[model samples]
Target chain A: MNAVSRALTDGWVITKRNLIKIKRVPEVLIFVLISPIMFVLLFAFVFGGAINPGDGVSYKEFLIGGIFAQTVVFGATFTGAGLAEDMQKGIIDRFRSLPMSPAAVLVGRTTSDVVYNVLSLIIMALTGLLVGWRIRDGALDALAGFGLLLLFAYAISWVMAWVGLLVPSVEVINNASFIVIMPLTFVSNAFVPIQSFDGVLRTIVEWNPVSALTQAARDLFGNLPPGETVSDAWSLQHPALYTLLWVVGILLVFVPLSVRQYRLASSK
Target chain B: MAVAGNDGDEGVDELTEMISATGLVKRYKNVEALRGLDLSVPEGKVLALLGPNGAGKTTAVRILATLIKPDEGTAVVAGRDVLNDAEGVRRSIGLSGQYAAVDEHLTGFENLEMVGRLYGLGGVASKARARELLERFDLSDAGDRPSKTYSGGMRRRLDLAGALVAAPPVLILDEPTTGLDPRSRQQMWEVIRELVGAGSTLLLTTQYLEEADKLADDIVVIDHGRQIARGTADELKSQTGGERIEVVLVDDGDRDAAVAVLGQVATGEVQSGDSERALTAAVTGGADSLSQVLAGFAAGGIAVLDIGLRRPTLDDVFLSLTGHATESDTDSDAGSAGGEGA
Candidate 1:
């Protein structure tokens, strides 16, 4: 086989190895499947009454899109943590000594984590619908929304893949991603309408990629209440296209970057 | 020691050079791991890199296996340049590192199969090879269980099996039995012996002198990233002395007299063992020296509990070369040597 095909074949093998880990270790899977359910329930009930999306939009419906955006973004950490753990375990050394492609480890890790994010997304969506979130748009539009979320999650996973290689430990990746992701997810239009914040914060939320993703999901799922319009910013108006741009931008910057790091990351 | 001469005289055939490295200098920040280290192994031969911890054995293996590039110098394995044609070198070598690299969450079967497939074996072939290796390693009963459930020895066997999955012509094992129990270490040695018997050119590193003596056809002794000595085990032993005479006194009070008696017939300084009553001394005339020592001890009324004339161990060879004991025997011989120096 050619180099590209060989790399893909090797990457698929690694991906399968990772997936088998998730299967054998039920504890890891339990946390992955439970976190989204807990998020949906906690935000829909605890913060549901306290927040307003304006114009009679149920907080549950408004929150679902935001939660979807946040969950997938958070899901990217799996890629980083997995890579960090593998680096520490000496498994990367074995892989490096092989005749496989250089980029195969990062590719396999990020791709397998997309499956994780997809599984969590399905769980979160089911929980979202049970708590009074509705899909008023056509099935094709909703599918597009989920597709965008997965694509965005996949891109972010590469960013985390790079972080995982840069950090010394898997625990550090957890804390480091938390410090960055919390502010990015919470400051956006994920939890409340962009109009809730005023001036600088509102502008920041409007331009945030998380905001674009949430806005896009709300638009595609038809979750926007009657007589309510998204923010006037170009990013919010073309939410789907804006989120697509972020996805493309992230992959372009991080794929090669993470692969470079993986090559230099030796077992300590 | 009569370090085996690097005359470049092994028939001058290019095909015999399975592994050749020159001036391999690797530095990690302020510490130099390899300083002008050079090594060569002919085809179908086992060359042991013998040294204590932090001796750059792992660094050399990593360089040869294409896992890392040296800061300076170049190596060729299986006729491919490690620095330039790394992939070609990788295709011809299998490396089992200092630690078992098997996935804890994957079954023994899964880990081997994964390695086989990554080596470009087809799915069916990978599965078949995985089974064959599992059976060979005596891990067939636990092949389906995750490696986390296996014992330390079982995991090591599986890791070695993973390295062999591709059936590469050259294998590098870095401290494969470092942490294993005696039984496990023996089992690992047996497996390695079988590989050598099958005529696979092998390079293995170890801290254990007995391991090198037992397995390697040629041994290179490294210290501080440089080779201090290289030769066949017998040649190395002879370089230090002909044989060792170890005597254990029946009473601790007789130790000093025994030391004096042993010192008289000894060719080199007599060294005390861990126990005050026991001592080992290098002797020149072999069996004649052993009889002389026995007669002296009998006349001295040392009343020895045990005595024997044994061939010199690698430890003695190391002491003769460096004036210090092996790391494992640091407490006793090193202390005696230090005291004598003082």
Candidate 2:
């Protein structure tokens, strides 16, 4: 087989290995499913009453899109943690010594983690519906919104994959990704409106890829309040296009970077 | 004498070297893990790389397995250069590291099957190969169970089975039996022996002299990333002299008398043991030397608390060659320590 086909076949095999871990360790799935549900309810009940997104969109409706974006972005860290754990466990040595394509492990890892993001998205959507959130847009648009969230998160998985290979241990990757991801998700429009922020924080939110991700999801889900105008910032005004650009840009940068790192990542 | 006319047949009868490496040098930032190490394994023969922790055994093995590149060296395994044709080397060799590299969450069968598939075996063939290996390694009953539930020995067997998934021509096992209980170690040795009996060229790294003695056709002793000695197990043992006679006196005051008694039968230098009451001496005659020493002790009026004849261990071999006990060296490079089993 050619290199691309070989990578795909090898990657599919590795992806199967990773997916089996989820089946055997249901606790991981439970935690993955539970966190998004908890985020949905906590924001819908606690902040839902106190905060107004304005222009008559209910707080629950406004919150679900942000929650979906946040949950999937957090899900990307699982890719890093899994890779780090594999490095620590010495299983990567086995993979490295194999005749498979060099890109297979990272490809398989990031691909399998998409399953986590998808499952969490499903749980969050169910919780959103129960909490009085509705997809006001057409079915295809809502699907596109979910697709955008996954694509952006998938790109972020490559970034985390690089971090995972560089870090020495799983704990370090968890702590490192947390330090970076927490602010990336929180300082954006995921949990609050960009209108509430002022000055540099506002500009940061306007340009933050997380903000673009949330704004795109909100627009595609039709959760944006009727008659509410998006910010004039090019990123927010064309959030879908902006998020797509970040997705492509991140993949372009991190794919080669991560593959290089994987080649250099010795278990020792 | 009668075979003098058959000289030409001897050339054809010689085994091909399946694995050969020359002047392998690997350097970590501050520590040099391998310093001009050389290794060779003839077809269907086992060559054990023997050393203590941090002796660069793992580094040499890693280089041969194509898991890491040597700073300077030329290595060919199963007819493929490690640097220029790493994929070919990888394809021809199976590597089982010190740590059992099986995925803990995967079933024993799944782990082997996954490896087989990665080896380019199709789905049906991979499944069949996994089942066959599971039976061969005595893991059939546990085939469906997650490998995490396996004992240390079982996990090692599964890892070995994973290595054999492709039936590669050459196998590199680093510390295959380290950390295993004696029974498990013996079981692994038996499994390895079975593989060797089937005529697979094997290069294994180990710290246990007894293990090398039991399994390897030739043994290479290394220390601090350099080759210290290379010979068969018996040749290495003979280099340190013969059987050792260790005697512990009942009274510390008998130490002088004990030394004198031991020295009479000693072929080499008589050495004092850790305690003042004990002494050790290397001797030529295995049983006769013990009887002669007993007679000497009796005549000299030396009372012994404990006495025994023992074979020289890896420690003896290391001490004889390096002028230091194997474990006494504390300057293990970080690279080796990470790769060496505890």
Candidate 3:
């Protein structure tokens, strides 16, 4: 087989290996699905009374887009932690010795994680619907919104893949991604309006790619309250374009970076 | 010791070297794992890398398997250069690491099937090969269960089966039986012997001298990242002066007298055991040396608690060459107990 076909076939094999883990360890899938449901409930009810999205849109509708954005981003952590755990195990040594494509392992890893993000997205959307969140836009726009979230999540998987290869242990990868991701997701409009932040924090929030992603999802889903004043920031005004740019940019940079890291990575 | 010729200038041989490495040097951040080590294993032969922990055996194996590159060396396995054509080298060899590398979440059959697929076997063929290997390794009963439920020995057998999925021409096993129980170790040895008998070139590393003697056609004794001795097991044993006479004294004060009597029959220096009440020496006459030592002790009126004639073990070989026993000597309680029983 040619190089591209070889990588795809080998990667598909590895992808199958990873997906089998989900079947064998249902607890992991339960935890992955449960956390998003909990987040949807927590933010929808606990903060729903106190916080107003400041428009005709109910907090639930505005919140679903943010929840989708945040959940998928957090879902990227699975890639990092999985790769770290694999690195600590002897399985990686077996993979390295194989005549399969070098990029296959990373390709397989990042791809299977997309399945995880998809499952969590479905669960969260169902919980969101129960809590009165709806896709106000037509079906085509809603599909695009979900697609964008998955695309952005796929890019982040590569970033986490690089982090996974860099960290020494699974625990370190979890802690490290948590440190970076918590701030990135929180400072964005995922939970609260970016306008609420003051001074320097506002600038960081406005420019954050995660905020752009949340804005893009809201736009595509038509979840924004009618006549709600959108952020004047160029990124939020063209949120879809901005989010697409970040997706392309992240994949371009991190894909090669992660594949290189995989090449250099050695298990302890 | 006669070094294996690095250049193919030695008289023409009917056998080809399936694995050949010269001047292998690998330096980790703090330790030089391999320093100018050389090795050669002819096709269909078993060459054992006999060494203690951190003796660079794994480093050498990793280099030959194309899992890692050596900083200063050239290696060719099955007619492929390891550095320049790593994929070719990988295609030609099967490697089983010190640890069982099977996926715990996958069934024994699935793990082997995945390996076969990675080796580029078609889906149907991979499944068939997996079943074949599972049956051969006696894992057919557990083929459908996740390998996390497997015993240590079963997991190792599954891991070994994975390596053989492609039936690569050369097999590199790094400390394959290092942590196995005696029974499991015997089973693994038998499996390895079967593979070699079927004409696979085998290079295995182990700390057990008996393991090497039992299975290896030639033994390469390495220490601190360098080859100290390379020869057949018998030649290596003779280098340590053949059989050993171990004596336990009834009185601690008789230690000096015991050494003096043993020194007459010993071809090498007499070594005192950890306790003052025991002494051991390497001798040439085997049982005759034991008889001579008994006569001398009787003539000197020295009391003897126990005495026995035993073959030189890997520990004896290490002590004779490196001035230290194998690193596993103190902590390997089971291994030492088995040695005493032998």
Candidate 4:
């Protein structure tokens, strides 16, 4: 095999190794799996009737798009945590000593994490369905929604992988990702509509990729979220286009950047 | 001790020089682990880097393997520059670090196979290589087990086997047998010797004098991050001067008097012994000096239980050159009791 295929093969081998860790010590994936499910239950049951906002949709169904967006953006933190821990454990040092391209490491790790995010999405969606979440769109639209979330999460994993590589320790990873993810999630339309907030907060959310993703998913799931504050672009009319834009944009900015960081880090 | 640079030898064996490092220096924060270190390995030869802890042997290996860059210097493995052609260097050299390099999550078979694959072996070739290594390393029985469950020696062997999976001409090992039991250590020594026999040049750092004596065709001794001595085993011993004059005293009472007598006869200071048993020391010349040493002890009325003249050991060479023990017992009660009491 050539360089790229060899790298990808190495990546898959590494990815399988990590997945085995998650399999044996499954507690690693538990937080990622359970938190979203709990949020689905809490928002759909505990506070759904009280908010009683319009659109005649059950709070459970309405919250699906918003929480799916929240779950994946939140999952970015683990990407940093995993890479940092691997480095601290000297596993990354072993990888550095190998002949494989350094970029393969971050790519493999990010791809594996996206697979976990996809699993988390499935668990969250199933839990949402069990509690009466109904999709009003076609199977294709639902599949597209799932694809969008995974792509966004995968892109974010690259950015966080860079953070993990740069950070000195995994302890810093745990602390920094939370500090970064919390504000990014809250300021977006994950918990509330972007229009409900005014002034600069509204401006930030209107342009926020998180909001764009959530609004896009909501439209695809037929949850019927509000629209058109950011631009007159086609994505403003279709959530699919908006989600695609954020996914593509994140890939463009972070993937190469993370790969570059991985290269520099291994050499040092 | 001062060091002189290594001059190129007359005979040329390009395949034997699996690794060559010149003026290699590695810095960690404010500390220099390697200071202008130079090394050469003839094809199908094992070179042992002998030093105590913190002697920069590991740092040298890291630089040669391209796992870490040097502060200033150059290393080449299979003629690939460690700085300019790092990937090429990596492709040709396999490194077994101070720690076990196995992936804990992967089975032994998977770990070896993955490393093999990383070296560009295709599915069938990599798998075949992994299986061959597993059997060669005597790990076939444990190949399916997670490496975490393998014993320390087993893990170390597996790690070394992983390094060889790529069939690299150069192998850099940092303290490969540091923690293994005596039996395992011997086994690893044999494995390394066999590798050299098969045309793989190996540069290994180790604390075990016997390992160096047994395996290394060339020996380089480092202390405080400098190459204090470098030569073949016999050459090093010969450079240390004559054969050792060792005596075992019949009683503890004669120890001091024997020291005084030998102090007069030998060029070096007499090494003292503990209170309980015997006095042993190394000095030059065999039979002629042996009689002189015995006559001196007898004149001093120091009873001699046993006396013998033997060839100088690596330890003798080390002490004759550096005046320090290879395995310094800093934790001996005689040295540390006061501190512990305080």
**Model 3's lDDT to the true fold?**
0.87
Badly placed stretches (over 4 Å) of model 2 are B1-14, B249-303, B338-342
TM-score of every candidate's chain A: 0.97, 0.98, 0.97, 0.90
Better of 2 and 4 by TM-score: 2
Candidate with maximal DockQ = 2
Model 1 ranges with Cα > 4 A deviation = B1-15, B248-302, B305-315, B325-342
Tens-digit lDDT string for candidate 3 (B1-342): 123454568755457788888999887765577789999888889999998776778778878877777889899899899999999988998989887898999999899999999999989999999999999998999999999999888988888988899999999888888789999999998999899999999999988889999999999999877999999998998878778898999999888888999999988799988688989898888788898999999999999888999887888899998888877533332322211110
lDDT-wise, the better of 1 and 3 is 3
TM-scores of the models, in the given order?
A: 0.89, 0.92, 0.89, 0.83
lDDT by residue (tens digit), candidate 1, A1-268: 7867877888899999999988998799889989999999999999999988877679999999999999999999999999999988889989998888888888799888988988898999899889999899999999999999999999999999999988848899999999999999999989977777999999999999999999999999988877666678999989999999999999899999998888787775
lDDT of 2 by residue, B230-254 (tens): 9999899998875889988899888
Ranking by DockQ: 2, 1, 3, 4
Model 4 clash pairs? Answer: A216-A239, B16-B42, B16-B43
Residue B110 of model 2 has an lDDT of: 92
Whole-model lDDT values for every prediction: 0.87, 0.89, 0.87, 0.76
Pairs in clash, predicted candidate 3: none
10 residues in a row with least lDDT, candidate 3 chain A: A259-268
Q: Each predicted complex: what DockQ? A: 0.59, 0.69, 0.49, 0.34
Q: Considering summed lDDT, which 10 consecutive residues are worst modelled in model 3 chain B?
A: B333-342
